[model samples]
Target chain A: MREKQIDKLKDYKYGFTTDIENIRAPKGLNKEVIEFISKAKKEPKWMLDWRMKAFERLKNLKEPNWQKPKYPKIDYQDIYYYSAPKSASDKPKSIDELDPKLLETYKKLGIPLQEQQRLNGIAVDAVFDSVSVATTFKDKLNEVGVIFCSISEAIQKHPELVKKYLGSVIPLTDHYFATLNSAVFTDGSFVYIPPGVRCPMELSTYFRINASQTGQFERTLIIADKGSYVSYLEGCTAPMRDENQLHAANVELVALDDAEIKYSTVQNWYPGDENGKGGIYNFVTKRGLCKGINSKISWTQVETGSAITWKYPSCILQGDNSIGEFYSIAITNNHQKADTGTKMIHLGKNTKSKIISKGISAGFSDMTYRGLVDISSKAKNSTNYTQCDSLLMGNKCGAHTVPYIKNKNPESNIAHEATTSKISEEQLHYCQQRGLNPEEAVGLIVNGFCKEVLQQLPMEFAVEAQKLVGISLEGSVG
Target chain B: MLKIKNLKADIDSKSILNNFNLEIKPGEVHAIMGPNGSGKSTLSNILSGKKGYNVSGEVLFENKNLFELETEERAHKGIFLAFQYPLEIPGVNTNIFLKTSLNAIRKANGEKELDAIEFLKLVKLKAKNLKFDEEKLNRQLNVGFSGGEKKKNEILQMSILNPKLSILDETDSGLDIDALKTVADGVNSLRKKDNSFLIITHYQRLLDYIKPDYVHVLMNGKIIKSGGPELALELENKGYENFN
Candidate 1:
């Protein structure tokens, strides 16, 4: 049998420390900490009350243990609830005013925050150490009536809009990570596309976790109004450390009548050292809703980082004739573990959904694909197609699939297909006989396995994702 | 060009080839004919360095120790083997596979890589001569190919790679008269003074197209007879029962 190679997260080029003054609240979790965070952001009273409710719910909730990856004891009390770079009221007005260290960090990552903003035509929102440093291309976006800004700013400027859709899709009480993120989310991007408008350019955000002993809880909310369209990209990287860090983020997307949202994520968070000593535990909740007729939502993710990942980006197809799609390639190498997939809930008539998931497990890691496809009785003649494939690289690594299907309507047509294969020695020998080394042979074979998923990404992003896949499983095979 | 001395091989403690010896000169086409249960296939497997064989022998190619070299290293040294059963690799296109392979060999010989345009030009030329469908080059390697097409593909690969010493392991196993001519023509086009060929078959039908300079009869674990071209015809007229 041929074994699949799980990708490993290397010390990324963006892995750099930024030294700056940090204004931090005391460690430990309680009502006082939640209130301090809300007051620090100067949120409205109603928003604070909502967070308090989420916090109350979190206090009684226990961590779910049915996942395939084992969880070590996480000390929630030792994590700082709020740790900002500096001044809460006076944000940096330009790149020149921002800390040189902060600017230099992005420069090393090959994304010049200010220069690229003008030359690359990509609007960037850089979040460093629990605060939004700068958001570029604002004037051009505003000309087209696109509200692209930090969520913190959205709360103060467009209170009614933020209040109406903050938790519309993924409610605060949805899951453990979602609830925790609602109570302590410091900063994340928020976009609202006006009715009948299509955003001219792509909106992107780069999240960085710098301060030590601080957990990152970012809440991203995007709402596309009726007949509007938007494309959003999320990227993340963390500095190397000897102690494990926690990142629990919640992302909620809402598409109104005839609206379409294309969301892509390139998650390259730090996966522990070669010996599996320290890394980040990423537990995120991201979901989108087709609330209006003819609406559509699609998610594409390339996850090659994190010590342990627990995420399920889902879609609720509620509007008549709405569509939902998911494409993902999750690679786990070394001692890393990942339990990630998607959920499609069809509630309206004639709805449709498609899921393509590819999982690669290398080294001593274990990976599982957990998904749910629910077709309610009202979803008359709905249709769904799912394909899940797993590739194992070494004898020690493991890959498993657990799919749940609940079809309440006999009229609905749902099909599921899955296959698991190892990289065959015969194939490798054939390549080696032709003069390719074992590493090069593995690269060619693994790339072929992931070509389908990579095609769904944006042009430039697809190239980056391809290289990430190759780099992740570099030394695991011949 | 090649020398195999005192070759002794076994699989799972069952000896297949015992004390096998062969010597080939440059520009010579040698054929080894044998009945079933002989060590015909084992010789090819041992020379190509396929794992799981308990082989003890001295295989000298280009006056160098071939056994000490890795599979790819031996390939770089200009030793090529066309398998009897070519493995199918799904999702790996033939174009990229051939390019990577050719470049690996080229780089080992201190040659620069041929880009997509240059490589495609060379592949199309060889592919056309072998009468292969160019559309199949875009598909996975040997995947869903007919028997005749696979044999033709093996010959095309051999011609493109241009190895010095080619071992044709039962290349005529599944080819018809038409395919035999095509495969034979592919081999004859690549024949040169500095190169040699080892054609292993069970009958004299293949030798009719690509005539061999010498023929040997292998039975049990070792070769029992060696003669000129008429030896193949003699064995065809009088089967191996008399030799045993």
Candidate 2:
């Protein structure tokens, strides 16, 4: 009887796909679809011209073959390039004025729409499918000379700022997915902190994919002026489905002299079913550039849900006395695959960087960590330290580490450490002997292993991320 | 309250406890003094249901077959083991862990769970009696704790759990005289007519504070001598060679 109950509780939640109405373009890539999208959004002439140039470049760019996973050829014309919330116009100004059904969807996902009245310390910009639905605390941010709005709105309001630094860190021809994002990106958040001003509250963007058979391509850019500081968080969740979804996003950060930027991400995409049928294909490109003297940038991410994840958020220290740090915790379970890490490029004197990555694999999942540390000839007295560790919970799972280090400056100091360990039966028994069940024991130990990374998150999101970790590994133990 | 008959155990195909037999009634404190490699720690581990040991035994606790039970089930049945080397669980506050463990044991025994106020009062009183600093209770469990402090924390847990049968595995190995006395006094305070203890040690210093009712000398793989509390004194003076 107990065995039957256990089997019943192990049923997958995302096994069923929703049959919703979808408006799709014809199966082929042509200039007609680009024109149709631009016309549909009623974009300006310059914007359309920019999209046309990006489209021409996308046609010539070749797919990248550096990643580990193998895949079939992508039919660009087969995918719907543009999707939006049903009944959405150009943009909505208020939550009540938005489509009632779209608001209901956000409510089901537990994102409070009236965030301005509910939370005073967090500024939220909610993006539904392909467009920004509502942005809260705009007036407060405007008073401090800070700009927090949608990328499209930023292009219209502050065109000079967007054109000056857009694609500076991540060029249009960086990679295959990045080129795709550069061409057909729909909407994402844009943040700009002024000089000598420390933002009083955290800024956040919550992304949700609602339409079926549609790909999500968003672009984010954050620029901190001299001596400014800001902390940003990005969270994403999609509806349960059985078909693989594509998400390609690009995020770039620029920190000027004496400025600091800390970015955190908690990704809970819909993972595939137990039989490995369908889930999200997450491919993202994120990088930060420390341009001014004594600047800093840090990235912290906790990835627990996805079918195939390929991402590397990196930092480039081009300023003297600058610092860079990356802390990541990635967990894969039940046929999931993840190959994620970071890169630190040092090009200035007295630069330093640190990387700590923890990967946990369970139930036949495959996980790996790949990172690079490069110190250029001009980077005298530069230093870097990296430690990557993997913990395997079951015998059937696999873990691997591949690190690349290239140094040219003789005065630089670099240290790298990597270790792979398994959860011994003895440790589990010890915890179980203290009255903890097997699932709880595994959760405790895994949490302990990832404490160094989880502590890097902001206080508010750290609690939520920790709970998500426990929930993600609910039945993977037994 | 506990019985072992014809207990044969091995680790990695090497025999540790061969044909061992022992029994302890309620309200009695039994000290098992043994030399190195005598399997005193193995007995404690097997009683607490630790894995990785192949065993052929008939062990009964409170009239229930112990081998059929999981480690947690055995713990729920009022059996506690103080590890010789306590693990350091980072990011888990000591107070929170102690309260969670106490409440789990309570809920398993068909008792109501304690609220924050009650748990705080109980733990504060126990911590004060054991001379545990209030600040240490707020930090991560056993992370960066001194050797003496870890032992004191084990006693703090034993006190809060209030188990019917407690097994101490080398609890006094790294403790000084003052900490050893405090730990023993804490154990003596928890003694009741319905509870028992099985203390495993290499020396008789801890027995000086909490006098034992029975002493057993173990050699190789079995107990070779048994006597009253005076046997501990004799063993401390003479050593295990005399028993052999």
Candidate 3:
């Protein structure tokens, strides 16, 4: 009976794809494909040259085996390298000119792309499949000396800025997926706030995976100059499918002297169908560098949906008085597997980092928290605190915590704590006694378990994340 | 308002409440006094429909068979149990939880739901009467609350729920004299001609604040003695050693 109920919960919303026109590349990865993508976007020569070099790196790089997940060998020749709508190049100047089907899709997803245009203060970049469709509030961002646009457009228009900062923090060989993303990432948001300029409003990017055969490789970069500040949010979803899809994206942040950056992600990727038939393989690399004195960078993620997720948004504190923080809530149900956490590297004196991770595993899913905190010899008086907690829903699911702490600076104060426990039947009964149903009871307890991380999200996003948690773990209880 | 007949219950195959029987009518406050290891808490747990207890016998609330309902269903049927150890649900504010629970019960009973404004007004009135700090309603449900505060919170919940049969399961155990009096006063204010209470405690001191019309002594999983309110003072002075 329990197994049957678990199977029922495995199939959730966002598991169905719409039938729409799709323009896709031929199955293969080559220099020609890179040139084809660049030519399709009508990019400048320097941009083509960068893509060519990335292609070479992609060809030489091998898939990594260090992560806990079992990586099935992806057939680069069998996957479409690029896909978009047929008339994607014709940028819609307004919502009326946009494709009705595309607009309706975003509407159903509760993202009012049209309303965003009317909202003058906020800037929005909406990415569909492998390409960014529209960017709003450019003028407002420009007034504040903020450069926000698609990576493709940035590569063509601001080559100098892209050249100076791209892959600076996450090098080409940082990991297998990062290397792959560097080689073939089609388009993602890019933001650059000039020195001393604070972004006027929250910047947001919404990513939607529409095409079936294409893997999304989006590369995002946000650079906050000296004394500048910016808060960025990223949300993602994919069309439902039975076969597992792959999403390998990379994000890098650079915070200069006295600068601060808060990066938030609410990933609601399409998990597999019931019986664990098809879903997404989410492998992402995101890290920020606090490079100057008094700089701070924080990464907060609420990951409740996805078949198999392997991502760790990290921070590197490289300057004196720099600070780093990572708050995450990773939940898995059915047959999902998630291995996610963060890494904090302290190389400057008086640097500090804090990591709080909450993992929830229901059904037969397996969830793990893998993190590292490293204090270099020069990081005198560095302080770090890490806490990892997991809430197991049922007896079938598993939760594990693996922490690697290295402290070369004797003066550093580092504390690490971990705990793994199952949700007591008594708690569930208590919640049920308070007039909540079994599923609602489970949702309440799980939300309480991840309260710390969930509190870090924006108010609007926190509500959405809470609903997603309930929907994701719907049939895992009772 | 509530009736229990030959209520036999077991925890992990060990019988806790063996053929226990009690009747609570509207407007009446009955106190159950017992020694340690007695089934005072077990009776409360059973009435609240907690899981893992193999219960047999009949429990009727508001003329309806209570054992046939879910825990929440029982709550909706106006059966409320104030736990001795209220689970601290962090991140769930007391006001929000209480409102949700109250509205759920109201909705189940075919009553209209109260909006935030109305809820705030009701909670404020109850909090003032209970002398509970209004700020406590906004904090996470008993997350960092002291023992007295937790007991106060239970009374607060009981007051908001306005159940037909309210079971106080050692509600004054860890409370100070001031908090105990506050809690008892809260209970006293909530009492009505249509409501009833079953106060379960080890000491007779709680009865001093909220006088009970009747007292029963439960020992070794059964009620061994029953009498008027003076029975509590007798047990408190003589101890269960003489009776056992």
Give candidate 2 misplaced runs (Cα > 4 Å): A1-28, A115-117, B5-21, B90-96, B106-125, B133-140, B143-146, B217-227, B231-244
* Candidate 1 segments exceeding 4 Å error: A1-21, A35-46, A84-90, A116-122, B24-27
Predict model 3's lDDT versus the native: 0.85
Backbone Cα, N, C clashes tallied per candidate: 11, 0, 4
Docking class of 3: acceptable
Q: Candidate 3 lDDT, tens digit per residue, A1-478?
A: 0122333554455545656677776767777777778887778887677667776777667787777767568787777778887656666776567777877777677676676434345567888887888777787788878999998889878889998999899987776678878778888999999999988888889888888878888989999999999989898888778767889999999999999999999888987765666778999999999999999999999887778899888889998999999999998888888999999999999999999999988888889899999999999999999999988888988899999999999999999988887878877777777787778777777787788888888666788888887888888876
DockQ, 0 to 1 scale, candidate 2: 0.43
Interface RMSD of each: 4.9, 3.2, 3.5
Q: Tell me the TM-score of each prediction against the true structure.
A: 0.91, 0.91, 0.94
- Tens digits of lDDT, candidate 2, A45-149: 676677777777887888886777555677776777777654565576666686666656655555666644435587878776677777778888999998999
Candidate 1: residue B238 Cα off by (Å): 3.4
- Model 3, span B1-244: residue lDDT tens: 8888999998888989998888988999999999889988888888888767888888888788887788888888888888888887867777888887888889889999999999999999999989999998888888889988988888888888888888999998999999888998889887899889999999999999998989999998989889999998889888999865
Model 1 per-residue lDDT at A101: 74
In model 1, what is the error at residue B101, expressed in angstroms? 2.4
Computed on alpha carbons, the lDDT of every model, listed in order, comes to 0.87, 0.84, 0.85
Residue-level lDDT for B66 in candidate 2 = 90
**Best-fitting candidate, scored by lDDT:** 1
| DockQ score of the complex predicted as candidate 1 | 0.43
The true-structure Cα RMSD of candidate 2 reads: 3.2
